[model samples]
Target: MRQRRWFPPLALAVGLFAINVVARLIIRLGFDGNDAASGRASIIMFAVIGLTMAVWTFLACQRKRPSDWLLPDLVVGAIAALLLTVLVGPFISGGEPFKDGAGDFFAQIWLYAGFAIVGTLLGYWLAVLLGRDYRSRALKAFAERSKSKPRKVVRR
Candidate 1:
């Protein structure tokens, strides 16, 4: 059976959101009344999410062009995940989205966006540096193939 194109991005979003869910659960159960511990756990969770995106982006860049996967898969998935984390994640922690006010809500969004962008850039840069990205490999192959063929001389 053929798989749908949208499936990947949807799955990516769900996976990212699942990370958030797990973090929330841990924070809720383990650090219920401790603001400091909850803050530390939240930071760790965001870092994990960023790292996940970095690894995902690196692997994706190896198999596909940036134009093919960046906005559609990575950005869309990040946005979807961000929405889920912000809107639904609080429920898991037994709190409302706006319980901490609009400032905190917006801050969370900003942090997610910052981490996502940085992670993606880091992954893509690493791939490019290692010459493992699709474009680099394609260019190297083309150069090698061209070098192997002899150029024809024009007859006077």
Candidate 2:
């Protein structure tokens, strides 16, 4: 049976949201009422998210073309995850989404976007440098195949 096109993006979104949920839960339960600690934890959570995205991108680039995965999978998933994190994540921490004001809300969005972009770039660049990305691997295979096959002679 063929897999659905939406499944991968949806799965990725859910995984990213789960990470947010866990981080929110930890902050709520363990760092509640501690402003400094909460700030530190939030930084750590964002860092984790960035690292997760980096690893995810690295592995994905190995198997699929960026054109194939970048839009349909990564962007969709990241957007979904961003929405969930912005709208639903606060509830996990026992708070409303906009309780901290619009500025803070926008700040969160910026942070998420910045980290995601940086992570993705880092992952893709690393894969390209290592010649492990799909394009690199495909080119290598093509070169090997051409080398193995001899050129045919043309009849006069």
Candidate 3:
């Protein structure tokens, strides 16, 4: 058996962190004094993250069975991305998450976690609804195999 590689999940984590860094840069440099614009950008960033996760989850489910490590990879990748964003991203924007206040820090965490969970659930449920989950695929394969087999002759 071949070992599963971690490159995909690691890349996803880096990509998510990069998105956060871009959002922080836009808020810090482009909309420094404009509260409304900053809020809008933040919301858009969160939406993008949620959508990304959802689409990724959907595609992964289509390609692999649930017993595979897709969900675990997604969870671990999200945690890594969240940690990178909260702990290191602010530094790039020349700000300290805690120095600003605890409220802001916690808010960011809640927003990231909420979006990730919602996205994952939505993706998985949508796949199940569409008959694309592991059980559906397995049942489909079994049905096909059963149909293709030669029927044994038996007369009552």
- Superposed on all Cα atoms, the candidates' RMSDs to the truth, in angstroms, are 1.3, 1.4, 2.8
How should the candidates be ordered by lDDT, best one leading? 1, 2, 3
TM-score of each: 0.96, 0.95, 0.87
Clashes of 2: 0
- Tens-place lDDT per residue, model 1, 40-102, is 998888888889899999999999988989989898989999999999999989999999999
* lDDT score, candidate 2, position 155: 100
Q: How many residue pairs clash in each candidate?
A: 0, 0, 0
Kindly report which residue stretches of model 1 are placed more than 4 angstroms away from their true locations once superposed.
Answer: none
Q: How many backbone clashes does candidate 1 have?
A: 0
What are the per-residue Cα lDDT tens digits for candidate 3 across 1-156?
124578667877998888888998989999998999988998888888888888878877887876674666788889999999889988988987787798999999999989887887788888889988777888999999999999999999
Candidate 3 local Cα displacement, residue 132, angstroms: 2.6
Evaluated against the true structure, the overall lDDT of model 1 is: 0.92
Error of 3 at 13 (Å): 0.4
Which is better, 1 or 3, measured by lDDT?
1
lDDT values of the candidates?
0.92, 0.90, 0.84
Query: Against the true structure, whose TM-score is highest?
Result: 1
Tens-digit lDDT string for candidate 2 (24-57) = 8888889899999988888887888888788889
| Better structure of 1 and 3 per TM-score | 1
| Residue 135 alpha-carbon offset, candidate 1, angstroms | 1.3
lDDT-best of 2 and 3: 2
